[model samples]
Target: MEKQVNAKPGTKQKKRIKMNMLIDNFQLATLTLPTIILLGIFAYWPMFGIILAFKDFKVPKGIIGSPWVDPIYKNFQFFFESQDAWRVTRNTLGLNLLFIVISTVAGVIFALIMFEVKKAKYVKIYQTASIIPSFLSWVVVGYMVYSLLAPQGGLLNKIIIGLGGEGIQWYTQPQYWPLILLISNVWHGVGIGSIIYYAALMGVDTELFEAAQMDGANKLRRVFHVSLPQLVPIITIMTLLAIGGIFRADFGLFYNVTRNQGALYSTTDVIDTYVYRALMNQGNIGMSSAVGLFQSLVCFVVLLTSNFIVTKVEPENALF
Candidate 1:
């Protein structure tokens, strides 16, 4: 009799727990529904088209019915064995590495300076001014760059002429593009890039800085010891993410900004622009798809390798 009564109570508790779990699941699903739909629509669904890389990919045969490459890697072989491969690879890695270093350093500096500013109005003004370039489209930026670099009447050439120097043909010269691209990329990206560091900076415990001040740490000392250390994790994560894109390039920056000028291809032509040019010339969907797939695979490998290194060095900061 006593056991029978306890069984009823235990059964009721189980039912209540089950009901609560169902309700919690419903709430979670409701919150996640939109995100799941978007990922399906934009991310996962597009992956179905990856088969195009191996296939000839004609419109009549469609993605599924298209015939695979003879060697199953013909497209990749063509790309790697081509004369432009070394040049494009070199340009892509060189520019991106340079960009990553310069932009990260500049963004951190800008964020640190901004975080130290006490006046809200001044902070707002500085932020607004810095971010203006990021808002401008690449097309507009191309025109602006042209105005500054044009051989006939560019501001830079004009300045050179006034200074008793020869007017440099910037677009036609590959030697100058590394510096030009670096400056242009940094100028365009620093504003937006700094925002992430700034947000991370805001999250740092104010008490830590106060303690550092009490310990007789000057502003520069505090920056190096306190702010910079706190920023290391976020910076590491961002840099790791950037490493994933080392094989890629900003199409707008390399293409539109350079006016797709063949002369600048020596320094400016990257994997993206090279693939684009190849696709346009050959009109081969499979080749273009192969390039995209190659980029993705390389990016994935880079991300995994970088994350693995981070995990070994700083498990807490590693992005798994």
Candidate 2:
């Protein structure tokens, strides 16, 4: 410029601060860039396939070129009209609700027990052992369950025989599946679930516990007042997230664990397993997609409604 304009000292300082802030933000963005790209490629890209739910998908025709169903809702009608619809829906909702309640309670109790250990090394050992099961593939877990429930040579049957009781045909009986599934689900999941609650417990204020001790509170009393109360927010958050997946079932658990036996289908058949069977047996992609989309919609609505209620009752704990 022809004329030199003098800049204020405060203006230079503000500019420098803005520049520094921008640099910090840039560094953070660079660190997160890989994650963003991966999510875009895997998660967002597959979203385009949602169109298949409406289309009468044909192998010869690509997704975009496929003809839309005649009634548009025809694919959805196929599922709703099916005889197994009510059974699968009920099993999905019931089993998931049961799993949520039991797992949450078990996790909390385990965490509390771990918290009382006092020694860091022992706590680490316990945590590592518990978490190991969560990493095992469902296929491996299925085989383990099979070994325990096999008709003749199964571990449980051997024990029953030892006790002079008849060996039960575990797989063929639907009546016993509900309890068996529940126990297996809790065992496999409780470890990882407890870790979450335990981490939250670690963040509790020590001063509160100290105050409780000073006020003549016993261990149980301190747990109820000091620890459980501290966990309410995190519990609320986790429960809300769980609610979002209420319409979905763990496909592996219901499928692999039950060995996909027709007899067990009465008690264990869920939307996910039903869709998988339909796809494998009938090769009806459109109907399967419709059920999946319906599940997603139901889950979304439930999550929003639950969040709304929580917001009204306890604004701070609401996820949104």
Candidate 3:
């Protein structure tokens, strides 16, 4: 006896999808062969060094022949017992948090203001000018800042002195560094962030704005009722990404801005700078790796928790 047939939707579409996937896989294999080999050679092959986190890494013997340890790891103990650990960690997290907040807010506001700017010529000019700061090397920026902010014969100081005001020791004053770092971070980074947010803003449907306008909604009401609501998903995801770096400060911004002053270490030092100083001062490879591992674990936890909260509140906005 002949069996009755059951019709299914999208069987043809599924067949096409499978065929396309096979074609894509074949093309990717051709494109990625060299890259995969390179990563295997230089990237994955070097992962063996990760064992140094467990071993007592000696410079002469190197990772391959290094001795491993178990009872109360000295690398970690040495790091913890030292006072620099807390200072560096606190500064790192604090400065990064400041950057995250200031950059996020300023970026969004800049994007909003850019959106309000009508002329395309002026918009592009302003946008270009804003993002130019982001492209400069921190070293160049540091010198430029020093040229402007230096106390002895510096531009700002010269102006202050011209006005008969006292010349402040900009580098020595720890109280001012935090504000300077915050402003510098925002100024350097906000443009790139604003561009991201502006791109997201452009994706917003114009019909919503039109509908709001018809209901006697002014620009302010339209923004609050239409624009901000549309922007929530983009905002949340961007914020989550920033939070992932809460434990990782921009090394250049913090270290360069402070001019690497030992006296400013309390206010200006961060995880990256601390690791740098540790390597410079202590020359301990194993301990540096351990500190890195600790930072990664904390950032991982923060990212996961933020994602979890986002999923509960707005599943659409959750990155995962």
Top candidate, metric TM-score = 2
Please provide TM-scores, in order, for all candidate models, with all chains considered together. 0.91, 0.93, 0.89
Overall lDDT per candidate, in order of appearance: 0.91, 0.93, 0.84
Better of 1 and 3 by TM-score: 1
CA-RMSD of model 2: 4.3
Best-first order by TM-score: 2, 1, 3
| Number of clashes found in candidate 3 | 0
Q: How many backbone clashes does candidate 1 have?
A: 0
lDDT of 3 by residue, 1-320 (tens): 77658646488888999888988799777898899999999988876766776777787887878788664376677677888889888888887887888888898889888988889998999999999999998888888889988877799899999999999888888878888888888878888889988888789888988999999999889878987887788889999998997888788887787789887788898878888888889788888877776777899999999999999999999999
- Candidate 1 accuracy as lDDT: 0.91
Which regions of candidate 3 fall more than 4 Å away from where they truly are? 1-20, 24-47, 70-72
Q: Write the per-residue lDDT of candidate 2 for residues 1-320, one digit (tens) a residue.
A: 57557755598899999888989799887899999999999989988888899999999998989999999999999999999999999999999999888988999999999988999999999988988888988889999999999997999999999999999999999989888888988889888998888988899999999999999999999999999998999899999999999999999999999999999899999999999989999999999999989999999999999999999999999998
RMSD of each: 3.6, 4.3, 3.6
Candidate 1 on 1-320: residue-level lDDT in tens?
25554444478888999888989799887899899999999999999988888887788878887788899998778888999999998898889999999999999999999999999899899999999999988888889999999999999999999999999888789998889889989999899999999999999999999999999999999999999999999999999989988888999998888999999898889999999988899887787888889888888998899999999999988888
Better of 2 and 3 by lDDT: 2
Relative to the true structure, candidate 2 reaches a TM of: 0.93
Clashing pairs in 2: none
